[model samples]
Target chain A: MTTSREIRLRSRPQGLPAAANFELATVELAAPGPGEVQVRNTWMTVDPYMRGRMNDVKSYVPPFQLGRPLEGGAIGEVIASNDPSLKPGDLVQSNFGWREAFNAPASSVQKLNTHGLPTEAFLGVAGMPGLTAYAGLLRVAALKPGDVVFVSGAAGAVGSLVCQIAKLKGHKVIASAGGAEKARFLKDEIGVDAVIDYKATGDSAAALTAALAEAAPEGIDVYFDNVGGGHLEAALNAARPYARFAICGMISMYNAEAPVPGPANMALIIGKNLRLEGFIVSNHWDMMGDFLKELGAWHAKGQLKWRQTVREGIASAPDAFIGLFTGANMGKMLVKLA
Target chain B: MTTSREIRLRSRPQGLPAAANFELATVELAAPGPGEVQVRNTWMTVDPYMRGRMNDVKSYVPPFQLGRPLEGGAIGEVIASNDPSLKPGDLVQSNFGWREAFNAPASSVQKLNTHGLPTEAFLGVAGMPGLTAYAGLLRVAALKPGDVVFVSGAAGAVGSLVCQIAKLKGHKVIASAGGAEKARFLKDEIGVDAVIDYKATGDSAAALTAALAEAAPEGIDVYFDNVGGGHLEAALNAARPYARFAICGMISMYNAEAPVPGPANMALIIGKNLRLEGFIVSNHWDMMGDFLKELGAWHAKGQLKWRQTVREGIASAPDAFIGLFTGANMGKMLVKLA
Candidate 1:
């Protein structure tokens, strides 16, 4: 028997989850059965969507059950395998996270080709968040060449990729980040046309409107929304005629105790003929091949870049997740377990 | 020369428009010049969208110019013609309303066939409103056969037609109306599968949610939003996965003195994978030919029916328009001038 440390949901959260809501316990793992493999996790992701799963609500994804190990995107190395497809020492990706080691059916995990790239890229740029930015812009928003695009949460995992991709696609890109450091990173590293430090302004809507007018005088054709509430309202105010908004995530309202108000100017949608569509990347798995090919090419050409705020060891997983609500991370927030 | 009584917009309204905002004056009209025709107005349409044009803000249609005759859909007969394209007694439709008689270029008007149907049908069923219902449902919403559809303001011009068209296409439709009379019209005349009397319920969202659950327990596939605010919130809550919303108009908040709140549950758009698109019928003029052909067939087969609230004379046009905000009209509201 092998001992593995795992984080389990002790109870459903009321508002923002506390450290007590998660219980870290050591579990004895059984040997791999037929068609199964034992994986020692290397890295695990903590995303905003995971917050919604902590509550007992019917949503796109099932709620994380009580007293069970939390599930998310993770990259691990196969330790023991009874399946023909995967062997010991092979690297793989699976939806088995918040645990140091796990035994899952081999069919449930995807074998990874590192291709000399960091294995952790599968959790950030080449993984779920990256694919989200790709499918949302290309398919949902129907972004065109020369289109002016605005992205909120511009320094986060998904928004960072979206800004880079929009720039590479021959479109003018405007981004909004929280702090000075994030704004500087977006401007200096990603090379966005404009970066609005949303934290500096007292009135978010007015600030965004002024920033957008200066960056895109003709108004934005596409708005990729990662943070909803004020960001959504600001985007609506700055949208051009027939603008498209791809609603990826709304990180701002994830910890709200009560129902928050929506944009006051939603009626502008009728006058401007705007289209707002919400999507999940998992639903568009068919686009994975194209996304990987293009992303790989961009990375090789030195046009793509990424960052991470990683916490070491399985014990730090809860703190990492709680930090996402406070905008503590510059890029993807992950926990490394070796 | 002849005298024509015209109603002009004297000034923009602060909130809801009043009769003082318009000026009715008699103007001397000149004889038909080269390529022009003198038309005596017969029927003029007063629609909900006209309210938006009363504000000095930029919108889908340009704001009605101050100190000028307000323009809208009108049907008139040519009393005299100078162009070869039109002659005396020819019935034509033009965007020259709020006037008893006017002289316009013959090229500016569309000669109507009528085809044993009333000439006023060109202003309601065969005109912009009908085409709006067709393109919004078939094209914008991408309506599929056997899909369940929910229509707000179901007894009005566009919503009533949408119900019949959805029914004709083998889809189940649930309708919402403001009163018992309008509900009866929707059920008895339009033959909608279910009807919700929105006014009778104290809480709009709860009432709509309960009504929708009872009517379409599987959840609505398409939502045609004529009334925004709470209705939109209820629709968002009752929508199934991958649902579509064709936002044609939002009559509820048109006369608000202050900025009204939007749907609080818009985040459900993400979990449900919903697509909310706003459209202007003018942008879809390309679908006119197909719209007329299909609508004409339905009317001839007795599969279509319509109602109108007619107020006599151009002087009653202001009252007719104001009545729309109070839900005073059952279907198309019009002013008969001849």
Candidate 2:
């Protein structure tokens, strides 16, 4: 029997999750079944949307059950396989994460083709996050030629990609993030036209509104929303007539124990003629091929860049997941396991 | 010279408007100029949207200037004309309301066609409000064949037409209004599938959510938002995946002294994949021809029905406007000034 350590949900979170809400457990793996493949995980991702799955509620995806190993995206190498498709030592990707190793049907996992980039890029830049940014900015918001793009959480994985894509399309981009480091990274590395450090002012509401106005004097045509609360309000305040907003995620209110208030100026939506739409990346897999091709070209031209903040070992998985809420990672936050 | 009595905005209201904010003035009208026509007003409209014009803030339409006659849709008779396009006694419509008589360039007003409907119908059922409902339901909301529609302010001008049009297209409709009389009108006259009296229960938020759930057990595919706040919150709670909301107006928040809190569960927009869009009718005039054509067919076939709450003379215009907030009238509210 092979031994594997996996993290299980100890309890459902009340508000902000703590490490105690998780428990590390060991499982014994038998030989692979008929269509199953034995795999050892290398890297896994922890994202903000995972918080919603931790609760006992009906959503697009099923909630994570208590005392069960958590599931997420992971990159692994096949150890042994009974299936003809995947061979031993072949790298693959699957939704069997939070564990050192797992046994899943070969059909459930996809063979990894790195496309000349690192394997972890499949978990982030060139993977889900990349597709999310591309679909949201291009299709969901219907980005046009002269659309002034405004993105919240600008230094994060998906947001940075949105800014870069808008810039690539020759549109003026305005970005907002929390810390000084992120602001600098957005300005110097990503080369965004303007940056709003959301944490710099006493009255965050006024500051964000004024900062966005200064960034785009006329108004934003498209808003790629990641951080909702104040950012959504500010976007509404700064939107010109017929602005379109792609609502991707709201990391700011993910941990709320109760319902939080929405933007106060929602009535402005009618007078300003704005459209706000939300979408999940899973519902838009058709765009993956186009995304990968464009991303490969951008990568080859050295115009694409991404950063990783990784925590080592299976035991540190909970910390990596918790770090997302505290803005501990500048880009993609991942856990390395072997 | 002809004498005419008119109402002007004396000052902007702080919260809900009162009669003291208006002044009745006497104007001495000169003879028709080279291209001007002298019109004696017959009927004018008092809509909920006029409340937005009472504020000094900029919006889709310019704010009503203090010490000037408030401008709105009015049907009148040209008593004298200097332009060849119009003749004496020609029925016409112009944005020259809150007054008994006026002289304007003949080209500025359209001679009423009436389409075999009453002259006042041009200001209510067959006019701007009718077009608003048609364009908002068909184009903005993109109402599909199987869409279950929910309408707030279902007894009012725009919303009642939305309910009727959806019903005419053979879709199930759920409606909400304030009082028992409006509820009866919605159920008996409009033939909606369900009605929710928003004032029926003690906890309005819970009541609206439950009512909508019971009304649409499978969940609503489209929401026509005429009243915002609690209604919007209820719609979000009960929205199915890929639901579309065409935000026509928000009567609930128009007279606010300060910005009111928006829906507390706005994050649902992402998980539920909801689309909320706002629009102004003036921006959608291109849809007028299509709307009037459809409306004429429906009326000729005896499938379309409308009601009017008439307030007599120019002096009652302010009360007619104020009564909209207090739920004094159902269906199309108009001021008759012969």
* Top TM-score model: 2
Best by lDDT: 2
Candidate 1 wrong stretches, greater than 4 Å: none
Q: Candidate 1 - CAPRI tier?
A: high
True contacts reproduced, candidate 1:
0.80
- For candidate 1, write residues B1-338 as lDDT tens digits: 88889889998877777889888989999999999999999999999998899898887678989889999989999999999999999999999988999999999998988878898888888888899999999999999876799999888889989998998998899999899999999898889999988888743676788888888899999999998887888899899999999999888888888877677777888878999999989899999999998988898898988998999998999889888888889888899999
Evaluate residue B295 in candidate 1 and report its C-alpha lDDT on the 0 to 100 scale.
86
lDDT tens per residue, model 1, A151-263: 99899999999999998988889999889999999999999999888888633666777877878888999999998887888888889899999998888777788888778
Quantify all predictions' global Cα lDDT against the true fold. 0.90, 0.91
lDDT of 2 by residue, B74-126 (tens): 99999989899999889999999889999999999999988789999988889
Error of 1 at B288 (Å): 1.2
